[model samples]
Target: MNDSENNLKRFGENLARIKKAKKMSYRKIAANCDLEHSDIKRYVDGKINPTLLSLLDLAKGLGIHPKELLDY
Candidate 1:
């Protein structure tokens, strides 16, 4: 995979890890943000990319810093 693809996959992995660590379900996180559970799922599956605003929303939903999502 290319660098961008690698980064996206790694980001998805990091998101999944943090979500699991916090014991939060996709619905739960989605509810706290402006996203849907399906969208979160796609993100975790590395099937799509989220914008910068979406990143902030995810971080808020997960009760974490936005940088944590990019830690990968």
Candidate 2:
């Protein structure tokens, strides 16, 4: 994988960990973030790289800092 792909994978893992820790499901979190459920799954699967704005929305939906997702 390329650098960008590796970063996305890391972010995905971190996001999944945090979500699980908070007892949140992909569907619930996606709804809270006003995103498609598949989008959340794709992100968590590291099959898609979210834009900065999408990341911000996800963090806000999770009541977390965006850096928390990126810092993984």
Candidate 3:
């Protein structure tokens, strides 16, 4: 894959890892933020790219720093 695609995949992996580690479902995480479960799933599946604000929202929902998501 290209660098961008690889990065997205890595990010998705990291997101999934953190989510799983916290035992949080997509719906549960979404409930804590402005995002819908579908959108969060898309992010975790690496099917969509998130904006900066979306990243922040996810971090907020996950109760973590935004840097955590980028920890890949």
- What are the TM-scores, per candidate, against the unseen true structure? 0.96, 0.91, 0.97
lDDT of 1: 0.94
Give the poorly placed runs of model 1, Cα more than 4 Å off. none
Report the lDDT tens digits of candidate 1 across residue range 1-72. 998888889999999999999999999999999999999999998889989999999999999999999998
- Candidate 1 has which clashing residue pairs, if any? none
Pick the winner on TM-score between candidates 2 and 3.
Answer: 3
Q: State the lDDT of candidate 3 residue by residue for 18-63, as single tens digits.
A: 9999999999999999999999998888889999999999999999
Candidate 3: residue 68 lDDT (0-100): 95
Q: Please identify which of the two predictions, 1 or 2, would achieve the higher TM-score against the true structure.
A: 1
For candidate 3, the per-residue lDDT at 32 reads 96
lDDT (Cα, tens digit) per residue for candidate 2, span 1-72: 999899889888998999999999888888788788789889989999898889998997888988888878
- C-alpha displacement of 43 in model 3, angstroms? 0.8
Candidate ranking under lDDT, highest first, comes to 1, 3, 2
For model 3, the stretches where C-alpha displacement exceeds 4 angstroms are: none
The alpha-carbon deviation from the true structure for residue 30 of candidate 1, after best TM-score superposition, in angstroms, is 0.4
Best by lDDT: 1
